[model samples]
Target: MQEDSPLTEATSDSRGASLLTSREPSPSDHSGRGTSRRSKITRKSHRKSRAGCVNCKSRRIKCDEGKPSCANCKRRQVRCEYPANPATSAAASGLVDPREPGDLPISEIELTYHWATTTCHSFSAWPAGVARVQALTEEVAMKNQHVLHLIFAFTALHLAVCRPKRKEHYTTTADYHYERALALVTPEIASLSPDNCDAVLQSVQMICFVSWARGPQAGEYLAFGKHGRSDWLVMFRGIRTTLASLSRDHFSKTHGPNTRGKGRLLPPSDGPFEYEKQLMELKEHIEFVSEPADRDDNVNSVEVLQEMYSNRYGGKDGEYHVAFGWLYRMSEDFLDRLQRCDPLPLIIYAHFVVLMHDLEKFWYMKGWTHHVMSGIYEALPIEHKAYISWPMARVGWIAP
Candidate 1:
């Protein structure tokens, strides 16, 4: 489980470095759930393929390619079947042949490889003490947080790269990072923060949204597996419940006003004033444009205002559409930066964008009982397709 052990492998190191071991106990250990953890494990089943189940691949252990019966499956005693359909089987092959239409460019793939190797090096550089701490806690040390951050951020970077390029499958390494991040944000970590309420809220919203995007009912963006179908809806509803808790009073006294007459200041409770202003500006912009102008020169405040309330209160009939015009644009900007320059913060921002995008989608879909994304999706121009694609691509069982 050491950082040097590699992600594809799934074996315990005697050195006491276990990155991601199953501490929750395999499903067989408990009979309450319908499925066991062994069945839930994501593994490839092609006999000739070397990149097998993450556990076997990492340990360099032999994989039987047995559906419900691989070596790992037998060891863990779980089902190990491969995808049933041709399209899915091809995807499970995990071979990125450049000849494939949607395969990443050689340069991009090389960059990805380089980044991954660099991340591994960084992970390895941690003091043995930190590794020991992480092993005991089953979580990476603060030194390892940067690696996780980069992993989350890279999703937006890939989105930006995918914007101009229309490939059969527009998903990227970022999605995988996001999924892992969600998996990492356990209840243990969340309970550690009591003062950082907003941070916790934001994190919860982000995970919920990401889960929804990759859940069932994701339509065209269903890149993950079938589990997304049930998960998407469940997460969508959960997002509403979480966000609904955010009544006007939910704003911190510092962010909102003590009295009605006093102006509400947003920066203190959130991150910064500039971000709040930028968010407000985007909200205003979305309100302004969501209408039909009688004259191009005239400002149709009435139409715009109506659209605003309608969107906020849920379209015409309690149907909510998350306002993510700003979130979408910001993600696109970060992505563009990554493609044109170093892919660090830009990648990180992409994860931020994905998290926000999920929040917006969850607010509207499960909360409102309508396809709120349609309005948001339709509101944008063709130029914004890539921004939409980032989240849309997550609309599968288990978005990569």
Candidate 2:
């Protein structure tokens, strides 16, 4: 036989090498098999957790499985609700069935009603007025989304303010509902209509209280304070203007030359009433107090001092008239100066707190006088502390 060619010899060598390689596993082959095995093991070990509370489960976190409230939600101070079994949760909780036609979920309706009766009471300066507003709001909220959202927003804000442990949760809920109310009412701000006027007014009032709750305290002035009283004053003016417009429109429609003013639609305007006269007296007192001693020829004028005393505390009209009267007559410039932390305005504000003491019978104004007075004391300079002394004394605070 002829000697094998070089090409035939090489081919035979390649076939032998391929057979040897197939017999022994390479590094890459071992790595691929190891990875596949690990993946299968991981898949087998992973299981969905059904034992956790709804909040933890939804967040894909491990739950401590505490009863009623899980550790995760308890730590966060959020509502710890479990997933209700379709057959039993509603009945167990005493909740109305949500499937009924024309009926809202019981929780929502109950919350809204609670807010109207209980939470709203805290914001009203007058119980009778709040009762009437609550009745009207309940009647209107069913038909108007704007009113409904405002009620929820007020409820959430009240909870946020009153419940310190759950403040974050309630604040978030308040903001969500407030935004919803704002979105619905923004379009109607410019266009006033009889149909939406009541809802709009109620919403504005609730929003003002919400703003008050969120406004900066004395401790927060250096860091978190915004425009302070300037923003509140602007809202106050806006509310007044809106009410005036509503009153005018209502008057024109209901009263005519031939008809008596029998049916009034809007509530009576919040007037200074007798407080108007008291305001004039206060203006005079302020002038007297601010007057220089040298300018007065009668340095020991008993009559002037006596009149000042009478007006200062609203002698016969009572302190409420004097305090609220000053508030009613306070100028925009005064509010602006207050926001700027002007010493004089702060001193005046402190004095006003004395009047607030008498008005604390209103749930909304309770503790406010003390809070504002304390804030002023903390914020003022040492030299300016004397200016607040009389007011502080009036409010039963002793200087330290």
Best by TM-score: 2
Q: What's the true lDDT of residue 380 in model 1?
A: 44
Question: Candidate 1: where are CA atoms >4 Å away?
Answer: 1-172, 188-196, 208-307, 310-400
TM of each candidate vs. truth:
0.27, 0.53
Please write out the lDDT profile of model 1 over residues 36-55, one tens digit for every residue: 34566955433542534444
What's the lDDT of the predicted structure labeled candidate 1? 0.34
Candidate 2 displacement at residue 249 in angstroms: 2.5
Best by lDDT: 2
Model 1 Cα RMSD, 1 decimal: 18.9
Q: How would you encode candidate 2's per-residue C-alpha lDDT over 14-74 as one tens digit per residue?
A: 3221111111111110011122246445532332346556568878987665544567877
